[model samples]
Target: MDFHLTPDEQAFRDEVRAFLDELLPPGRHPSDPEFLSTWQRRVREKRWVGFSWPREVGGGGGSIMQQVILKEEMAKRRAPALGTCFMGLAWVGPAIIEYGTEAQKQRFIPDILDGKVQWCTGYSEPGSGSDLASLQCRAVRDGDHYVVSGQKIWTSIAMWSQWMILLVRSDPAAQGKHDGITCLLVEMDSPGLTVRPIRNMSGTSIFAEVFLDDVRVPIEQRLGAEGEGWKVTVSALAHERSSIAEVEGLLRKLDELVELARASTKNGRPALDDDGIRRRIARFETRIAAMRMNGMRFLTKQLKGEPLGADTSINKLHRAALEIEMGDLALEIQGSDGALEKEIDGGRWQRFALSWPEVVIGGGTPNIQRNIIAERVLGLPKD
Candidate 1:
């Protein structure tokens, strides 16, 4: 893939930089409610909120390269995200756009773009995480509604989200486990549905164990046809596995590590002067650059209108390992003090140290990604 940007791409990058200067000036805090509100509003107004979606559905409909340019500029500036709804804009909205009825689009897309609703995915279950098609969350059709009954674990943002893009066994007796699944757009407040938050190692309650006991969902809210959820899942998961989204976050953390190293002393000398520390830092930066290139490859394929496939697993696996490595390296730099809850940077490093699994094992485990790469991307025979 060509590394050089075309003239139009360069101009677009300049445009994004200018937008940042005006709206996200240096020292701006994205966490500030007023600033964040204003920023989201401005980006939404400029149609950069959902820049990759179709224009007819109130999206910017920007080209793939343009989207890359936009995200790159924003990340370089450490600016806030373009939209507030995380899962909504990333995969859920795209899935809806692909398989949802026209009425569903009109009903859901606008809220997603405007960040009026939060969406949580309901794919993983007690029995079906990495092998998602084996999910047994039942959703039996009854008149105009489907009665859902089952449980999902490690459901991120389940307690906070207003909606769930759920997958269930709508046809339990179908020919295969993969063929019996169906996707549903479920409301969090529905009767018989329960959300019990799980306190993770990081001391946060973002993940949850969700139970659906005869939760009635209108058939109209079914995301795709019965027995076709496996296809929908495969497509949505491809988006989930794209590691491009994690690039900016890793870059920011790398910057923090660099700063920490400069301030730290080892053997009565600056830690930055330690050859070992320098090498580890360099290794991280190199890996990050590689992930960036992988991201570009994904973009390149999209530009050519090719379907994204298992190549995304390469980056996904890299990102999972990187998150853990980065966290461990940061704590290593802190030495003995790293173990204390509030030792370095008010325990930010400690929090990061404990937070690897969410990224490492969220979409798919590292082992799972490798299997995908070996068999699907490399054409290696599966044992």
Candidate 2:
């Protein structure tokens, strides 16, 4: 695949770079509340938040390559996120655009792009073993509403979100693995809904267990048709997994890791000067390059209208391993100082080190991704 940007793409890249330069001057941090507010407003005005979506729905209607260029430039400059609603922009918006009613699109897509509301996904179940198809959360049709009951585990941002895209089993006797499943756009404040945060090893509760005891979701809130939940979910998960495989974010992390090594001491010398540390950093760079190339290949396939399948698992697996390795290396370089929860670097390295489980297991586990690659890509017999 050709990595070279076309003339139009190069022009777009220049425009993005110029915009970033004006928005993020060298001394100003992107995180400042004042700057962030202005940043979000400006980006939204430019319609860069949902850049790839249709312009009719308040998106930029930008080309796929242009979207890539925009993200690449933004990440390179460490710009504030294009929008405030992470999950919404990442998957929900796209899914809604594809499968939602006109009313649903008008009601939800604008809020998602304008960052007016947060959306959480209710997919995983406690004993489901990551097989979303087997979710036991049941939602039964009752006149104009569906009364949802059962629990979802590992729901990210459930406590803070205003809405949830929930999946439930509407039929237990269906013969197919994915049959009887339904997707509903549920209001978080529905009477019977409850959220309980689940603290991880890092002591953060970004994930939660969501319990719906006869929570009534209006029939109109259902995304896609009944029994079409699997299709909608598969599309949403594809968007999610692709976002997880972002090479630009990994590159930024690599840059930070390099700086960390240069500033830290290892056995009486700068950590960056240590042979082992240097080799690891080099390997990281090489792997990042491989990821970039793979990304370009995926882009090429997308341009050709080919559906990306098991090949994406390779990047997902690489990202998980790279994040773990980089986090550990940062701690190793910091040595004993890394153990302090509130030391220099603001415990950034320590936090990163402890945050590995989410990345390693969130979208899909390393083992799951490897299984996908082994069976689908390599055509190996499933065990």
What TM-score goes with each of the models?
0.96, 0.96
The TM-score of predicted model 1 comes to 0.96
Instruction: Tell me the deviation in Å of residue 157 in model 1.
Output: 0.6
Residue-wise lDDT of candidate 2 within 262-362, one digit each (tens)?
98988888889999999999998888888888878887888899988888887877788898999988888888888788586888888888998877898
| Global local distance difference test of model 1 | 0.87
lDDT of 1 by residue, 1-383 (tens): 46888999899998999889998777777789998889999999999987889999999998877887887778778888888889988899889888889999999999999999999988899998888888889988899999999999999999999999999998878887788888899999999999999999899888999999999999999988888888886777555524555788798899999998999888888899999999999999999899988788777787788977777778877788789988898888788898789967899999998999988898879999899889988899996
Question: What lDDT score is found at residue 297 in candidate 1?
Answer: 78
Worst 10-residue lDDT window, candidate 2: 237-246
CA displacement after TM-score superposition, residue 19 of candidate 1 (Å): 0.9
> RMSD for each model, in Å, please?
1.5, 1.6
Whole-model lDDT, model 2? 0.88
